[model samples]
Target chain A: MNQSRNRLVFLALILLGIGFVALVRSTVNEYILSIINFVGIYIILAVSLNITNGFTGLFSLGHPGFMAIGGYVTAILTFPVSRKSMFLELPQWLANLEMPFFPASIIGGVCAAMMALVVGLPVLRLRGHYLAVATLGFLIIVQVLITNWDSVTRGPLGLNGLPAITNLWYVYPWVVVTVYVAWKIKFSSYGRSMLSIREDDMAAQCLGVNLFRTRVAALVIGAFFAGIAGGLWAHLVTAITPTSFSLILAFYIVVMVVVGGAGSISGAFIAAIIFSVLTEIFRPLEENLDVYGIGEIFTAAILILILIYRPQGLFGSREPGFLLTRDTQ
Target chain B: MASSNSVLLKVEGLEKRFGGIIALADYDVEIRPGELVGLIGPNGAGKTTVFNLLSGVLKPNQGRIVFNGQDITRLRPDQNAALGIARTFQNIRIFKELSVIDNVKVAFHIRMGHGFWKTLMHTSDYRYSENEMEQKSHEILELFDLEAIKDQPAKNLPYGIQRRVEIARAMATMPKLLLLDEPSAGLNTGETDELVKTLRKIHDTYGLTIFIVEHDMKLIMTICQRIQVIDRGRMLSTGTPEDVRHDQRVIEAYLGKSGHGKQYAQG
Candidate 1:
């Protein structure tokens, strides 16, 4: 009885949130709207990354590689056929093809998920710092590939003038979807398997959680959403570059998940928004002072402080009391 | 059911080695269904090696293991679990940060039977199985007298309760054979006594086969119907607890003194 009531209340809250997004879309200036769009994308990235790093305890840094795949795929599919033909050479079918944003975004995500499956099969065997390094290597490999594939990616120059179809309406729904799916997985049997693997993998195996299969599943699922975020990001910026999805962006997403509390969805949500807004707020200030990377330096300092004092992340793997509809623990 | 006389688990000429050192050699065991058996040995006696082989934690450089008439010598630990073998570690390994109930519910993963998409979509099967898991996990927790602290994280519980929770989690797997490795390792005398009751009650109530490794001689003698002794990786003796207690070799190799058996017997 109480569960149904909570569901009703949650539905109302979601409706109100969408209405608020619509209000901001109409009232806010372009600069503020862009920051809000960035927040939505970061929320997608941080919450999805939490599945692999937070729940499964697989310290991966390859999120940007998956994002790059999604971004490039979506950009290619959605690029105007006239622009595609004029900018670079392509195969007859792909050069002639132009798609709208929605299906192109989904295909980009699917492509990313497929790549994760291929990489995860062997790399997921590693653990801890070794896994982290392996994933970082993957990200670097992706960058080099994009840089060298001149025919398809236009080398270091990258593709530009992508249609700006990514707005609050497009990004916000994906944000809601990513967080909802992550929350559902967190409370499901698969979530339990992932958590058990994190705690003690040997014990999880003895109790019948297929260790390799669950690890790969977490990575694949996380990669799919990252791909979608990449699509949204490529469209929002109206351009794509090989260096755009860099190690810096990867580290920023990791920081959000870590400082938000790795295993807590609400924590990731709050952290992503706070860090995104803070970075945006610091950007103009850094420009005015002619100092570079002030935003990054400030984020690093805050990360260190959180590590020293709140090592479990801000929420310690549980939601705060107000977010609790039931006993999550 | 396989006939009552048929062996539930059969091991023949099992051997394991680490570099130049031998962990076990020519080790053999045959356990009929529903037996309460104990493996007792000194430190470095390869007692755990035997459990490791049986549970598929380590591949044997050796012989065959047949459980319920299927060869399981080469199966992995997860496969062994799916085949109805469950075990607890000598070092307690409950999911420390998870609630006690979640620890038990995790064991039901194999039997939950719903796939990823069903869970994501919150299909009817997902909700039904989840409800079933919650009720069943609570029932198992109640069996171990852990219901009062079900909501508390496993790490916050006393060592005794944590130990019981490990066993409770194993039982939730609904294993046909349960292997316990030094279950009394960190328990005090009072806690050990409580565990003795719990093990016996589980064995009696469920008719489940139990194989235990123990340094606690009282736990072995008080509860185990049959005992197997190993010293330096070879079987020293196997018999009823009373018969094995008086064996001369067991006293010298295991008890280390003739008086030790009498002390444990009286205790």
Candidate 2:
């Protein structure tokens, strides 16, 4: 009871932080708010995907595909029912609809998870690089279909003029929930089973782990979160192209997970924030400096250096709780 | 291990073949409750094959394995494990990347009832199970004198200690039937002696029906209550250690009638 109470107190503190952010509307500028929102979205996607790829040892590269499902689904639902002129390529059924934000977002997430269940069958059968390639193909297939499917989606022209509904209030609560869930998994027995599978599949199976079931559960749960992140992105940016959720975006999310520490949940969050900040700092240099491709070149270089120097990433497999190092003992 | 009347495992006509190589043609053994059975033979004596078949690693061509009075022939490997069959490999197969604590934690997985939802939610069920696994793993590690290296990655441990860690891992499953393949292999004499003592301690404390495959005659002779000798995929004889020591067929099986087995007897 005492431990539960202490944990509840800790969660209250986290919720207070989110509430505090919600109140500081005048002091925080839109530019800083944008960066905060971006970090939240990245953290959600990276940490959620880490649950599967890192902890469960399922190399899924189709996270962007799930996000695409969320983005398209949410965009379809929340578009203004009277705004037909805004969607030239949208079908009559979707253009004539307008649903509230929260329900639409959740439904979007649900659809993405269902799509994951469909894809996970053949994809999870392949291990290591084969599974990765198969999932990458799913991402490409999603992107190409979004670009060409003129009826429901806007096709290559893309969905536009989505309502900007995600504020700091909208994002930080979701972050707390997602991080709470991921961290819990890391310290739990199920988490240990997943880690065991990552270390040795045959041994884990011999120990009574249902290999296929665990992998699919991890993948589907991760996809649900990815979808939720996509819905948040759609509302925050108010527009999305098939190109936004691309293979490159997938690479960036994976980089965040890796540099944060692949198997570390809290590390994923830290890596997301650090990478999001670095991208923002480099945004202007890569944009107006006429340096052309040097910006991406440097980013790739830093990733290579990280892999060589600290392949386990900043935290390795350790979490933020052991940041003081003394607690590690 | 239960009372002697419990009848833990009964194997009859367990046969295996590897593309015309007959590993075990007609293997029969009855492991009673709480009995320590020694499996001995010359090189390629099909001892390991028996261990593999019982532990569900290798399926026999023809056999009936009545485990706990249940016919588990076509069960999944983990299902066999859930029925209280745990094994250690001849070549050590520890989870190399996991810490010594986690190596045992993985073994207690089936005993943990927490699911993905429970884990992700940090429910009481998850916390209780995790704490139980940690305490059990720590205790098992201490038994093998591995408490000092409990936090160390498994691969970093020395080879001999690694083997002890392997046995500790198998025991963490709380198995009713523990199959060990060459537990004394590669251990120095002092280590082998300690290994024998540890095996005895485990049998006494946990009461697991242990079936061990060992090449060391001295170790098996000292540790086992009953010795079963197998030669060329056939059982030579099985009896009390004193009876096996005097059995002529068992002598021919081990010393080849030219007579290393007789050398021990006549001397």
Candidate 3:
């Protein structure tokens, strides 16, 4: 009976969130609404990255690469059929193909997941700095491919003026899904294995946790969500370039996961919102003060301070007590 | 000696080398079901190497490991564990950030055979399995006398309890063969005595076959039905405690020539 009440309360809370999104969508100014959308996108990215870098203890810089793949796939599939033929020469079947944003986004995510499986098979073998470098290499390779694939990607200048369909409704549901899935996995046996791998992989393997499979699964799952976030981001801005998914974006996402708490889902979600809001607030302030790179400096300083004082991030590897109410199961 | 079919673990002519150095050579061990065997060696007699080979951490350069009538020589660590061979490390490797119960719960990974979608969906299958996991984890904690401190982070525990947690985690795997690499390495006499009792209780209760490597002569002599002594990566003697204590070579290589032998005799 008590559990049923908790579930009812949880459902009411979710409905309240949806209503809140609707209220903001109607009442908020365009600038603030854009910021909210950005928050939702970052939540997806940070939470997804946590699966690989935080939970599985892999140091990957390939998130932006997966995002790029997702964004391009969604854009191409959802592009106006008339616009598709005018901008660049796509293959015959792809040229005529037009899809809805939802299915296109899913396809983008699937493509990214497929790429992760291929890349992770070999790259996941490396650990520590080597793994980081290998993933960074993957990011670079992705950028280079997008830049050089002139006919398909239109060279360095990427697909532009995509339909602006990414609103709070779309971004909000994805945000909820990403967090919900990550939360579920985090609290399950699979999540325990991921945590064990992060703590001591050799020990995890000795206990019958398949190290390779678990690590790759983390990467693939993270990549899939990253792909979706990319599609959302591309539509929100209505533009995407090969240079858009740069090392800086990768670094920022890593900072969010690290600052929030690696293994804590709520930590990543909260950190994403905090950092996104901070960056937006700093942007106008920096422009008024004419201080270029001040935002980067501030975030870096915060990161360093966090490392020195509280190396485990805000929540460490645990959730807050309120969020852990149903933990008895 | 036991027939091949009766043995739970059969190792034959196991050999390993690190570059030019021979860490283990021509080692053989046969552990029958329900037997508690001990491996004793000096500091660098490759006792850990044997554990590594058996647990599939290191692929033996030359050997065959047959577990339950199937050859497991080329299996990976996780595969060996799934096949009912679980091991504890010489250095405690419990997940320090996790609670004591969570540490033990990690060992149930292989047995919790559910799909990722089920895990993510929180379906009835997931709820049922998670409940089962919680109950089993609690039972293990109770067996190890850790039920009271199950919620405490493993890192905050005393050294002896951390050791016990590692053993308890290994027990959660429900393996037919348990490879314990120095269970009483850093324990005091009292703690070692307590661990000996725990080992005996679990072995008799579950009919577990345990193969332990330890430097503690008293712990091994008191609990192990058969003990194998190695020197310079080769098997020196295998027999009852009394036979190994009286062997002239064991005295010279391990227990020391005369005075140390007397000290061992006193035990």
DockQ, each predicted model: 0.77, 0.56, 0.75
Residues B1-267, candidate 2: write the lDDT tens digits.
Answer: 356676788988889999999989888888897889999887898998888788776788998999999997666667888998888888887888778887888788888748877676667777687777877888898888999888898989877888888888888878888888998888898888788888999999987789989888878888889889898888888887788778888777666666566766433
Residue A29's lDDT within candidate 2 is 86
Candidate 2, A278: how far from true, in Å? Answer: 2.2
Candidate 2 chain B has its poorest 10 consecutive residues by lDDT at B258-267
Score residue A224 of candidate 3 by CA lDDT: 100
List ranges where model 1 is wrong by over 4 Å.
Answer: A327-329, B1-3, B255-267
Q: iRMS of each prediction in angstroms?
A: 1.1, 1.8, 1.6
Better of 1 and 2 by TM-score: 1
lDDT by residue (tens digit), candidate 2, A150-203: 767778878888889987777787788787777767666677778888877766
Candidate 1 local Cα displacement, residue B92, angstroms: 0.4
Q: Kindly list the per-residue Cα lDDT of model 3 for residues A207-324, writing each as its tens digit.
A: 9999999999999999999999999999999999999999999999999999999898889989999999999989999999998888788888999999999999998888776455
Which candidate number has the best DockQ? 1
What is the DockQ score of candidate 3, to 2 decimals? 0.75
lDDT score at residue A107, model 2, on the 0-100 scale? 91
